[model samples]
Target: MAAAARLAWVDATSGVAGDMLLGALIDAGASLPAIRAAVESVIPAAVALSVDEVSRAGLRAARLRVEPLIESPPHRTWRSIRALIEDAELPEPVRDRALAVFGRLAQAEGRVHGVSADEVHFHEVGAWDSIADVVGVCAALHSLGISRLSASAVALGSGRVRTAHGEIPVPVPAVLELSAGWQVVSGGAGELATPTGLALVTALASECGALPPMSLESTGVGAGTRDTPGRPNVVRVVVGTPVAEGGRDELVLEANVDDLDPRLWPGVLAALLAEGASDAWLVPILMKKGRPAHTLCVLAPVERAAALREAMFRETSTIGVRETAVRKTALERTWVHVPLLGATVPVKVAHRDGEILQATPEFDDVAALARKLGMPVRTVLEAAVAAAVDQHLIPGAELP
Candidate 1:
């Protein structure tokens, strides 16, 4: 089985900036030379990266500065950036990540200006520093092998900040566009979150909340250009591997629906999951006065509970939802793929004390294999389990 994914959770409690993100990665042990090289490989301008150890609000952090050789930089469009990334010699994942971040920025700007993302002209973020910051962050994340990105509630400072469009309000139009469904709070004065930072985080972070279950490895603080009054204007990134905790809290959102037709159950479940529900299911129940109904249940991280509820309300005929805090425990699990009938069948193995406890083929994979092989799902499942055993995926263990 492939090892579990390593994650980096950006703590944007103060705020996030492009330079601040790069500085944080540098502080977290990302190679400065490597990041500079990657950024140079993708941009036409001669890029200079300087990383200095600086103290912000009495807390030590890394400060990254980008100096470009070119003068009178030309404004760029989404298409041009895409072409630049596609033609660059950087790693594929890094290129894709940088492109994704920029794409989000373009999309937000496009939505604000009523243009398509591909045709949107990046007025401010098209500059050299913006490009370098986005690319360097992507390269650093790739170098650290961070496959998953998460964040805490973002903190946006108060007041107006100057942009290409003259004086604009704090948490600019682009920030609002990028933050449609995300959690953000305002703190202090001045522009804390920039379009570059907001786009990067919203585009990349798969989940946002309090620190998830992880074993701590390293933490880095990236300082913003200007220091805030009380706290250091910085964004912190925490890198670690996910581990199953003994006991954890989750929010359970439930809604009883008897009026909704059963045909739309799949769609509702899919919507809930797409909206960040950890798990969504329906259970048959009898309501008051012997009325038959189905209880739609959603288990989600508390941070995403609101989004999940909204999805449920939109997709199901549910007027009210019950939210409850729940404690849950789960075993350490690993998934391995076994080749069967010209298809890769994923087998879930649950373990305790590093010993193989039970091995079972994923039901979805089994059903797909059954359809492809013209056999029963049980038959496909049995074959996959046998193949996994033959491959010694779990030594001295029986299928459960």
Candidate 2:
């Protein structure tokens, strides 16, 4: 199980780039030697990786530089880059992340030019430094054990910027395509999220909103090139242990219908859950003119609000839906296998500050075990709890 210590929140308050991300990780205390060695294993020997402590707009940060001693084309095919990473002697997690970043770039390019991912030739990112930026950042995060990632909405810049495809508008075609469903805004008259940075952020982030509850560990600021007039050109990474379980903000959507059939509720709820709803249920209510109805409600991550809404509309009979942003706090969760009824059942264990707070068997699985063993569901559940207690899953916590 490759897992991070907790959470890493990247504040793209100013903007993000591959070098900036790697610099931030280095600034936050990831070993430069380790990152260099990992990146060197995949890239050319002449490409040197270095991190220097630099200040932008009076704020200090780490700057990552990749100096390729040999002259090379500023491009590589998606297949070539993928092969390089696959052949690199990097950790599994690092290799996987680097692949994901490049893979996203390939997909973006393919989408922009109507070509296949493997056939797409990376332009700006085909350069040696971009490879270093992608792989080095992965190595740095893996070295720091920052598994789960999140980010604030990225700042987009306006005006025209030159690219391998010639002078194009800022927030280039690929960058916009990569951020299709994400939060983005124009804050300046220049590029903020580069193609490399956007793909890196989009690839790894599981959630994008406010930072979750976590014990503060370390912070690194990666400085971008050129300063903006109103803000420092920097990307900050915050590393920390999750303060509690299943944390962060969520969105709640509601739709009330008086004309739909009652029999479809279960399937509708299931569809929402399958589409990434945290929880979905229905509340019976009275609509206008004494009409009876059920209010279908679901809680989902902010990003899934759109998907959830589509599911609701497609699966249910409702003309409109209401969405409300909500904060949801939850314990970090783990699972332990417990022997029960001569077989094994999974016990869900929830914790706070590393202390077990609740241990319960999955009711459905317990019920299945009960049917198989010809016993009551209660018997299976109780046996599972006893197994947890005997294993000391949560010492000093009461058990049923």
Candidate 3:
């Protein structure tokens, strides 16, 4: 409930691979025995998880390997996959968490393949090894007891890939589909990216942009199985205590433009966004004269003060802009796994008095699950909330 007490960032600047990402998490201190125990509980047949130190692009990392009891099979529908994960006799917490991951993957497959959740079979995600990777990673992440996860813009390699479906162009269709709402980059020398990697990012990353400024702490590099002549083939994970509370700080910058043209306002706002201002807007008012004017307001971090102030000056006829420091009360929020409306979604819980106060499904989580189940996001949100309320897990009350 306190969010594992650590912040994690995945440096996918060079790209992310399933195994590489799993290895990176392990390197970042995800327990191997805990992961194995979790996996064994979820999988019926006996499977062995092997971890070893390995190198990729000269960076050291842990390589996760799985020895499954059955031969790998072809694509499987979400229903089958869910059956496997649920039937694994896994602990309630692990089972619930693992189900959320599969539910996300299932929804993605359903969307990409144009089939129902029960009908959509996974090509890469269904493989035993991939299952171990995905579930194992989630188990490890949960074990880390971390509250928030962030990632840099993903680096997707350029070039075609041979899949069970056939040769597809670079940035495979599934990968492209999974990255629908997130920012991604391409042009690696080799096939350093995959659909599974992108899906994992899409499902878990809270934000997909540059690394926010934070105090440096522990770093773990997950090595991929490829070796290129140049850049290292590794995924790095950085876990630390955020220097800034919630990695957010408050600052307000304002400028009055009485002599500016009306047409210039739109451009100025866009410029602020391009410069990375958290928020920028205009407030209409009457200036010294009984005339009309606009107060250009910009809310951003202190770091963007110089650039934002410069933008206002360059764009408007304002003589100067004033900067003020302000305190903001932010909710200490964390995400919870909830089953709702025939799917599992991440419910963000904000609380006080050790009592349940506010709970809402993450929009992306609801949207993704909704799109997969062919149901409206609102319906799922309602159902999830209702379920939480009924389970007496809503924070304050006992089950009726």
Q: List, residue by residue over 1-400, the lDDT tens digit for candidate 3.
A: 2444566888898889777888888888888888887777666464688778876666667777777787755567778777777687664545544555565555566666777656876876787778777778777777776545678888887888787788878887667766665768885755667767775665555556666555656678887776665787888888776665643444677887777888888888999988768789999989885878898999864434444654665577764455555545655666677777656677777776566667766788778887888988788777777866655657554212
Indicate the residue-level lDDT of 27 in model 1. Answer: 89
Q: lDDT value for candidate 1?
A: 0.80
* Stretches > 4 Å off in candidate 1: 1-4, 245-400
Residue-level lDDT of model 2, residues 137-180, one tens digit each, is: 88888788875678889887888998878999988999998886
User: What order do you get sorting by TM-score, best first?
Assistant: 1, 2, 3
Off by over 4 Å in 2: 1-3, 246-400
Per-residue lDDT for 66-174 in model 1, tens only? Answer: 8879887778998898788878899866776787678668767887989977798898888878889999998888777776678888888888888787998887888
**TM-score of candidate 2 to 2 decimals:** 0.65
Candidate 3 residue 223 Cα shift, in angstroms, is 1.2
RMSD per prediction, one decimal? 8.6, 9.0, 17.6
What TM-score does structure 1 among the candidates reach? 0.65
